[model samples]
Target: MGRWEPNARMRLVRAAIDLCAEQGYEATTVAQVVERAGLTKATFFRHFPDKREVLFAGQEEHAALLTAGIGAAPEGVAPLDAVAAGLDALAASFSPEQHEFSARLTAAVAASPELQERDALKTVGLAAAMTAALADRGVPDPTSRLAAELGVLAVKQGFAAWADGDRDDAGALAGEMRTALESLRRAAATLG
Candidate 1:
C-alpha cells in the first residue's frame, strides 16, 4: 500500500497552527511543524519559510479579494463604504468552521508580541492593496488610503468580536465598528 499524503501547504499550515495552539508561538519549531504534518523538512521549507508565515497563507487571498472588491465597487459608493462592503464580502466568504479556525489563529497571533507586528504589517499591506484598487476605480484623494486603513482596522476588530469562541458570528460584529465610526464622525463634526 502507498503512504497517504496530505496536501503540502495545508499540512504545513495546519501543523503550524496546531503547534502554536498547543505550545505557544515562540516555542513552536519548524521541525515540530514538519513532524506534525507528517512531512519531511524539505516539504515544510518548500511551503513556508517559517511557522509564522504559515499562519498567514490566507493573507494573500484576502488581499486579492480586497483589491478586487474595491475595483468592482459600484459608482457612487464612497471609498470607506466600498472598503466596508469589501470586508463584508470577505466575511461572507468564510464558513463557520473556517471562521473558528481563523479565530484560533488570530488569538494565537494576538497573544504574541512578534506575531502582533506581523498582523499589523499584514493590515498595512491590505490597506495599500485596497488604496491601489480604489485609485484604479477613480478615488483620487489621500483620504482613500486613510479610509482603507481605517476600514480594515474596524473590520478586523469587528471580526474579532464575531469570532469570539463564546459565540461566533463575526459578520454580526459589524455593528460595533459602525457605531464606533459614527461616534468618531460626530466628534469630528463637533470639533469643526
Candidate 2:
C-alpha cells in the first residue's frame, strides 16, 4: 500500500492487530506496527497518540454515531427500544469482513492488562455517552442509567457474537443483539 491510500488509519489498525495477534500486545511495538503497515512511525503517530490509542481511535466517532442514533429514534419510543435503535445503527459500521479483525483485536486486548483497562474505560465512556443521550430523550434518572447500561451490554454481547459467532453479516449480528436485548428485558420483567 502507498501513502496515498485512503485507509491509512485502517491500515495502521490492521497492522497493529495483526502484529499484536502474532506476538501478543505487550510484546508488540509501534515500530513493528508501522513496518507491518508499510508506513512511517510519523504516520502512525499522526493517526494515534500511541499504540494503545490505535485500538480506540474510533471512540469519539462511535459515541457520536450512538448519540445520533438515539436522537433519531421516534418520539415516545420505549427507552430500551431507543437503545436498540442506537445499537443497530452502531453495528452498521462494522462490515462482514471486519469480523475476523475484531476477533483478533479482542484476543490482543485480552492478552494485555493495559489494553483491557483501556477497553474498560472506553466502554464506560460509551455508556456515559449513551446515558446522556437517553436523558436528553427524557428517559428518567435510574431508568436512564439502567437503560444505558443495558444498551452497552447489548452492544458488547452483540460484538462478541458478531466477532466470534457463526454469523457473518452485520444484519444478523444486529438481530442477535436485539434478541439479547429482548432477553434482558424479559429477565428484568421477572424482577419485582
Best by lDDT: 2
Instruction: Give the per-residue lDDT digits (tens) of candidate 2, residues 1-192.
Output: 776678899889889988988989888899999888889998998899999999777998888878888888999999999998888888777777677688998888888999999989999988999999999999989998898888888888878877888777879878877888888888889997
Name the lDDT of candidate 2.
0.87
Please, what's the RMSD in Å of model 2?
A: 1.2
Against the reference, the lDDT scores of all candidates come to 0.73, 0.87
| Clash count per candidate | 1, 0
TM-score of 2: 0.95
What TM-score would you give candidate 1 relative to the actual structure?
A: 0.81
Highest TM-score: which candidate?
2
What are the models' TM-scores?
A: 0.81, 0.95
How accurate locally is residue 2 in candidate 1, as Cα lDDT from 0 to 100? 14
- Each candidate's root-mean-square deviation in Å? 3.2, 1.2
